[model samples]
Target: MAEVAILGGGCFWCTEAVYLEVKGVTKVESGYTGGAQPNPTYEQVCTGETGHAEVVRLEFDPAQISYRDLLVIFFTIHDPTTLNRQGNDVGTQYRSVIFYETPEQEATARQVIAEMAHVWDAPIVTELAPAAPFYKAEDYHQNYFAQHPLQGYCAFVVAPKVAKFRKTYADKLKT
Candidate 1:
């Protein structure tokens, strides 16, 4: 009934767009975390100096979608096996990570990763870390994909990820 899930899976734009469509997600904030810098900017994160991964802070109603369901959708939308990269975007900031809010969430993330890893050929490299401070991204970056779907990056990269998420989590969508 109550929980928070923070995840970093590739570009925050792609992850934000996908989670926005999930029914239980009451709020989705694109941000930076697991880094050293306080209030790191998108540019700073892009530079990878903050030691923080670009992340999304999700506020969801667990009654509608369990944290476990969020983990499944996250795994589906991003390539968790790759290290510090998702497709063409490469950097430490782009690393796949899950910031668990509790011991239960941590366990669930690990269990899901283990199960899904067996289902896929590649080893899962998604890092499971304790939740840390999350600095919200720039205003324009908040909803990048939906705001700029025609943008080259969005058209070629984010759209496909969103479409895949929609198909995969069809039952869990917000409608």
Candidate 2:
């Protein structure tokens, strides 16, 4: 047992898929957070006005995987340099964010962002916010890619993201 972390890189489905493959990750729940509304539906969230970014909350063992490692995979899998967008998905709801579960997590997130700034040319726009009420997304959103890899969005978007994660973070993955 360790700590929990919440991150939004774009679609929760994609983030959930990648984290689930990590060895220390005990659970990954697709959910909504950083929003004005409470328990917003998926339809409401996609509108980009819910104030909530689609996020995946992960419960993991720190002894096996560090939050720092998770951030590395996160930055690699998606464009944190981009503001309010991941490829075609555009909106504040798609912005890169890390909702920290503790003070230590918050501090670590800030430190990682600073280090990444030198690693990448563009500035990282990832927000380090305190963890809020996490509203679990509909059941249909869970394990989306694993269950529906043949779906168009899963093929075009999630497949590449997962492959990139597997390729770039091979040593960190759960084999």
Candidate 3:
């Protein structure tokens, strides 16, 4: 069975783009979670009033890629030290967070964050919370980087993250 990981490390587009290249990730969907709203639209989430963070729902084969490895990749691809922001994208919706579905997931997330803390110069501000309702983003938000690779945001913001992942984790990339 495929295990799921919900992560919000700034824009979902950046996270989705990098994970899509991982060897065991079967699917990546951009969404909103960790919020009060039941089904927030992208615009609503973008407003930062929804209390939701833009997150990516990833389905991965654990036999091929451990959840720990996925978390490692996630931490590396984004700046978790910056609270409520990633690069120029700033807002509560862009905050770094991990919505774990189980006790085991929560423990793993904690361990990863602790381990990652030493790597960063500043404290790891990534939030660790229990899984909540995940509202799928609009149709246009899905596979955004792939569909609009040449778009300004994708070309500039998301592309570098994908490139860094490919370079840093070449063995984890799909053949």
Candidate 4:
């Protein structure tokens, strides 16, 4: 059976690019969640007034890759210790968060955070909350990295994260 995991590690472009390469990840959509707005535009979310975090909603086969594995990859690819920021991107919309879809998912998120804490020098500031209504990002943001690899942000920011993911999870890459 397939399961969904809504995670926000930073810019959805970077996270989406990383998950798209994972073996069991069947689909990855860049979107907005943990917000108050009904349907927010990129500009609104950017203003940080929408209270949304740019997130990636992943559809994956759990039998092939456990949620724990996904969480591990997520934690590795971004800095969870920093609040409302990821490298050059800084704002509430870029906050680190995990919006769990179920109680089991919530438990796993907590466990993963606890285990991953030892690896980070600072306390993990990643928020764990019940999954909220996901507002799919506009067409342009869907596959930003793949569609615009040569774009400055994609080339400089997203590419490095994807490279690290490939190097660290070589065996898990889709063949």
Candidate 5:
């Protein structure tokens, strides 16, 4: 069965690009969640008024890759210690967060957070919240990094993260 995991680790493009290459991840969709505005637009979220974070919802085969493993990859790729920012991306929309769907997922998230605490010098500030309504981002946002690998932001920001994932989790990548 395919299990769901919603994660906001900076920009969805960065997170989505990395997970797309994971062997067990069946699907990755860039979207927005944890906000009040229904079906928020990228422009709206970028303004940071919607309270939504750019997130990627992943469907993965747990038998192939455990949930804990996914969280570990997530924590490694992004700066979880910084509040409401990632690199040059600022505001609440760029915050690092995990919207867990079940009690098991919640527990795993908390456990992962604690373990990640030892890896970083500063305290991890990633939000572990209950899964909220997820609004799919615009069609253009889906598979953005793959489609725009040469684009400025994708080249400078997203590509480096993907490269890091490729190097660190080379065995976990799809054939």
Candidate 6:
């Protein structure tokens, strides 16, 4: 069976690119979540007024890659210590968060955060929240990193994260 995990680690472009290479992640949909708006456009979210975080909703085979493993990669790929921001992107929409679909996933997320605390000098600020309405991003946003690898933002920001994931989790990457 496939399990769902919605995570916000800075930009959905980076998160989507990383998970798309993971061995067990079957689908990664870049979207907006944890927001009040029924359908938020990227522009609205970018303005930081939608209460939504740019998130990637992933479907993965637990047997191949546990939710805990996903959390580990997520925390490493992005800085969770910075609240409402990641690097140059400063906004609530870029906050580090995990919207778990199941109790097990929630527990695992917390456990992973706890276990990873010592690795960073700052306290982890990643939010643990129940899954909310996920508004899929515009068609152009889907597979954005793959589709726009040479684009300035993708090359300067997304590419480095993808490279880190590949170097750090080579065994878990797709063949």
Question: Between prediction 1 and prediction 6, which has the larger TM-score?
Answer: 6
Model 1 lDDT, residue 118, Cα: 86
lDDT, residue 27, model 6: 94
List model 6 lDDT by residue over 66-136, tens digit each. 99899999988999999999999999999999998989888898899999899999999999999999999
lDDT of each: 0.91, 0.91, 0.95, 0.97, 0.96, 0.96
Per-residue lDDT tens digits for candidate 5, residues 83-135, read 99999999999999999999999999999999999999999999989999999
lDDT (Cα, tens digit) per residue for candidate 4, span 23-77? 9999999999999999999999999999999999999999999999999999999
Q: Estimate the lDDT of model 6.
A: 0.96
Off by over 4 Å in 2: none
Q: List the residue pairs that clash in candidate 1.
A: 35-51, 35-52
Residues 1-175 of candidate 3: C-alpha lDDT, one tens digit per residue: 9999999999999999999999999999999998898889988998999999999999999999999999999999999999999999999999999999889999999999999989999999999999999999999999899999999999999999999999999999999
**Model 6 steric clash pairs:** none
**Residue pairs in clash, model 5:** none
Q: How accurate is candidate 1 locally (lDDT)?
A: 0.91
Of candidates 4 and 1, the better by lDDT = 4
C-alpha RMSD values across all candidates: 0.9, 0.9, 0.6, 0.6, 0.6, 0.6
Best by lDDT: 4
Relative to the unseen true structure, what is the C-alpha lDDT of residue 109 in candidate 4, on a scale of 0 to 100?
A: 97
Give the Å error, residue 142, model 1.
Answer: 0.8
Give residue 94's lDDT in candidate 3 (0 to 100).
99
Clashes in candidate 3: how many? Answer: 0
